[model samples]
Target: MLDQQAVDAEEERLRELATALPDLQRQQYFQQLKRELRDPDTYAALNWCFLAGLHHFYLGQWQRGLFNLLVFMAGLALLFSPWPWWGLLFIVLISVAELWALFRSQIIIQHWNNQIMRRLLQEYSSAE
Candidate 1:
């Protein structure tokens, strides 16, 4: 439900916090941030292409990705087995969730990036 405006506001707030750091630390901080930041376009692509929750893995949500992968594999197995109905149900459920992620990929990615920034800043502060 987040618009680009909200993402921009959060980024601006993070930038303000960065002002407290020394120039050298700020440079290093931004370098690290750039390395760790996630991309919305990539997330959306993964969601659309795989639909097996690989997008979650891309964002470091390994547990959810594994769950989705397992569910997808199980669904495939069931789809060919005698009880295809169960497989169909599982596939439908997972697909619905993945579709939701695809639609909200921008918001999800921006929020994740913001969280990453906050953590990096906290870690940097504690080190000082």
Candidate 2:
């Protein structure tokens, strides 16, 4: 568990980091976020890839994506095999992999969205 002092210190550090960015870069960041949020189709497409474990490609994490894809394929193959035990194991593994990918993707997307929102809020506060 995190102590209150530690949490407060982290918040202060985050505020400092936000203040460090120049206005133009911060505006660009906010614009990018607004564009992403306004385009539902685009956002859906990107998020779909994340759910499929293919978003890593966009982030240049190809190796991890390939590994996950291969694992999923192997699980599918095993699931179709004649041996019941092997099939069950493969199904279980595949389910676990899918869940893990889903959770990771959600976290990544949430983090990105939060950053965008933070930038927008900061911009608005500064303007005011």
The C-alpha TM-scores of every prediction are 0.90, 0.46
Ten-residue stretch with the least lDDT total in model 2: 37-46
> Which whole-number lDDT from 0 to 100 does residue 56 have in model 1?
88
| Segments of candidate 1 deviating more than 4 angstroms | 1-7
* Per-model RMSD to reference: 1.7, 7.4
TM-score of 1: 0.90
Task: Compose the digit string of candidate 2's lDDT tens values, residues 1-128.
Answer: 22445544544665565566678755665566556533323434553554434555554568976775666566667767776577567556655665644444544454445555566657655754
Total backbone clashes of candidate 1, pairs 3 or more residues apart or in separate chains: 0
lDDT of 1 at 91: 90
Error of 1 at 48 (Å): 0.4
Worst 10 residues of 1 by lDDT: 1-10
